[model samples]
Target: MTAHQNGNISAEVSDFLLNCFARSPGWQLWLSLPLSLFLLLAMGANTTLLITIWLEASLHEPMYYLLSIITLLDLVLCLTVIPKVLAIFWFDLRSISFFACFLQMYIMNCFYAMESCTFMIMAYDLYVAICHPLRYTSIITEQFVIKAVIFILARNVLPILPIPILSAQLHYCGRNAIENCICTNMSVSRLSSDDVTINRLYQFIGGWIMLGSDLILIFLSYTFILRAVLKLKAEGAVAKALSTCGSHFILLLFFSTILLVFVFTLVAKKKVSSDVTVLLNVLHHVIPAALNPIIYGVRTQEIKQGIQRLFMKGW
Candidate 1:
């Protein structure tokens, strides 16, 4: 046990060794290639989306502004987790400073919560557009988007801030080897000598309360939208409404599926390999980020035109 004291706190492990599929050393090369591709794809796609939105004045609206927020969140998540994982896989630089680990954990928790909130707000925007078309312009204004962004940050940061804080406060007097690629609350807290029942409970309960509520609200919004769309007697009205919400539905489905898969793998650890869980956890950070902008770009006509215009201008 290497004791390194920082300020008032004494720690046996000053840095954490990430055990990212270390048992199968040969697989690291194979894993590193795809991870690197994913990182590039995510960075490129999100950067393009942000630039396109910024350059195109016509695309400036509540929906696009909210999309920019989601894009930013995805960029943050990918940057927070993937680069370190790649370093671990490729260069075998697995040791992460104690402070860095906790910072990554905080970013993972807080930004994910913020993304969920942003999605819920986007759902509300859809609900307003579909269920009450007349009120949408008035309801989802520039001021409304600004307030929603404020709420998203405040709601997530305040609640999730305690998770890493609580985990970091624990005394780590034992092993510093984290079984996963990233510093998750459970993995980091479990390494501590202190009892982490509170940390686990708060992580579980707080996560559920935040995500669960968002899911429920999103569901309610879509339900109303579906009902309203079905009631439309005008020709192409149903198709138009469906088209309007389809991209968001697809993105939400992908996000929720990834989240569910991670949760399931975590719960079924006995049946699933630790390597698979870790891989899924790492992929969770990159895959959605890499795909979100693509999904939006393909689905939204304005974004496609904006991209075309951007290319033409550059050429």
Candidate 2:
């Protein structure tokens, strides 16, 4: 009955929602297939990473020690949601149960925060090892990392619980189809007719604070690391330092992009083309998860040899 700007009658919110959900394009097939390939590869690579890191005592040193922990976290993180996320493309579950979506949101957010904390710890570890090599043993001890790891374990899960918990209380009397495949908090929020002011504010503030803090710390750490790497006169020593930090740098950038872009995009209402959305999800999860193992394996030669040794011995 109401006329719209284009001389068309204004459609109900529900109709718009249906259009967004149903308009998945043909090119999504391309996105979904490759993502599945990468996901499977990530699973296997992460398994090897876990086994190899635990088997070698040489890897138990402070530097490799932090690296091993990251491998484990990456495995847990990727496996926790990417499988279900991929499942959405195949299953036409246009609507997700409220509880299920909240659970997914909680899990995804928890890992996102955990990775942020991990990055900060990693930057500090490198700052000490490279910047203060003489005191590396004393400064970056096993005890220091253990405490930080414990704190991160507790801290990451604690903050995100609020958002999902609050969301579970909202009633949905209407449309529930998720536009994109995954069950992100934004999708759940869109379903609610009640005031989402609190949830939106929390997401914007909490998400940015976590991502900004980690990134700032990483920048500062690298500043000091670069200064130290430059002071080293030996080409061989400089190469070694660069090699170690280089992989971590690349991996950090990869993870940061995936986590930040996905979280930040929640506010945008424009329906992402199915292909683009799937591609975003794939690169966000698959490539980062797969690239992580490669970064660790290639940069740390010992890991490659250790994994080979492990396979040979098992045989």
Candidate 3:
């Protein structure tokens, strides 16, 4: 089935079938089991963390609030990609409407960018708290978070909104199978008969502008944080300070590393199987969602205590 754009000569496919993995269907059933477990863990862990933060008055600071936002974005990102993926894997429900595909593409782009921006903000939060101990409270206020959120939303959403729209305008000439689990902009655009150079170039430029800037800022913030931590004369104080920022740094490292691996896999596509690339892409979304909350709950003392309080009350 094809969709006709307004008086245009080119035809677009009305729906798409996701090329999930190897053509053999048996492996997918086994694959779905672990993916389902990850989704469940991601949802459960993030929800519990959100609730713990909500109930614990001490966890109501700007840092926790930013963490909560990250949890929310992670939840949304997982929900957007995983359910449909499970449906595709388990039930052979591979067909996705054109508009639905674009919507998924848009959400994935926007949320990933938002998550990157949030990490940058969190890095700044750590920097302020550690480097400017006296002014940390004044610098990382509720109003500052609100402004940062606004900036994040506007910065990411506005630039990414056009990507899916541009893809939708392309003539898809009956090539409707997406070679990945999620509706990535490039994956969808590649199906189009038109030259995807513009699409690829725009996304490349926009991604660097958004994620690149954030990564650079995050690196600088951590550099300052490390320098400040080293200046402390007391070993105990240095250890305590490092402990506070260590978890955030670790999660950030995981996020950046996986993403870099995915990019490298794409660049080295001739040597890597498409399955490996697709698997990496899928893991990129779910792994962080599953791990971020667990890391925070384990590392953040207040959150750990709040979780204990919650469990004790339940008991």
Index of the highest-lDDT prediction: 1
Error in Å for residue 225 of model 3? 0.9
User: What TM-score does model 1 achieve against the real structure?
Assistant: 0.95
Where model 1 places Cα greater than 4 Å from the true spot, the runs are: 1-11
Report the candidate with higher lDDT, 2 versus 3.
3
As for model 1, its CA RMSD to the true structure in angstroms is: 2.9
**Candidate 3 residue-wise lDDT, 216-305, digit = tens:** 999999899999999999759999999999888878876786468658776988887777777778877788899999999999889999
Model 1, position 43: C-alpha lDDT score: 96
What is the Cα-based lDDT of residue 33 in candidate 2?
Answer: 84
lDDT of each: 0.87, 0.71, 0.86
Task: Give per-residue lDDT, candidate 3, residue 312.
Answer: 88
Error of 1 at 114 (Å): 0.2
Q: Model 2, which residues run further than 4 Å from truth?
A: 1-21, 91-95, 259-278
Name the candidate that leads on TM-score. Answer: 1
